[model samples]
Target: AQTVTQSQPEMSVQEAETVTLSCTYDTSESDYYLFWYKQPPSRQMILVIRQEAYKQQNATENRFSVNFQKAAKSFSLKISDSQLGDAAMYFCAYVGVGQFYFGTGTSLTVIP
Candidate 1:
């Protein structure tokens, strides 16, 4: 069985600042995918970024980047130049055969 772990229950960042969310996982499957999804108050799932297990380079999307340590079974999300709109619940998820397994979630607060 595979599972995603998010150690931070909540995180806050000032406007235009940066914040990193820590995550770890345990999985026996070698080939899989990791994702970070953001759900605003509206409850819409938004794909923040993704990293492939075989890819050595970290995945990045504009202000978002991931530090994927395959051996350690860890994938962390870094949000740079965050804004007030970034306030949402960030979840670390794993995708396999059918559905995705999400973490408990981390409530991100953007301080203006």
Candidate 2:
């Protein structure tokens, strides 16, 4: 069984500032995928970033990026110059073999 852990229950960042959210997972399988999903108050889950276990390069999109440390089983999300619209609940997910796991979730609040 695999489990995703998010130590930070909630995070806050000012507009135009950067914030990093930490995530760690436990898995026995070597082949797997990690993802960061954001859910606004509306309840829609949006894929923010993804990292393949076999890839060395971290994935990045626009102001979103991930720090994937395979050996440490750590995957952190970095939001750059965040906006008020970025406030939402972030989830760290892990998919390995036949199982899928999601963290409890971290709520991010962007203050203007």
> In order, what lDDT does every prediction score?
0.94, 0.96
What value of lDDT does candidate 1 attain over all alpha carbons? 0.94
Per-residue lDDT tens digits for candidate 2, residues 14-99, read 99999999999998888999999999999999999899999999999999999999999999999999999999999999998766
Error of 2 at 111 (Å): 0.6
Residue-level lDDT tens digits of model 1 in 16-111: 999999999888887889999999999999999999999999999999999999999899999999999999999999987776899999999999
Best by lDDT: 2
> Which residue ranges in model 1 land beyond 4 Å of their true spot?
none
On TM-score, the leading prediction is 2
Candidate 2: which pairs clash? none
TM-score of 1: 0.97
Candidate 1 lowest-lDDT run of ten: 94-103
Q: How does residue 46 of candidate 2 score in lDDT?
A: 94
* Residue 109, candidate 2: alpha-carbon lDDT: 98
For residue 79, what is the lDDT in candidate 2? 100
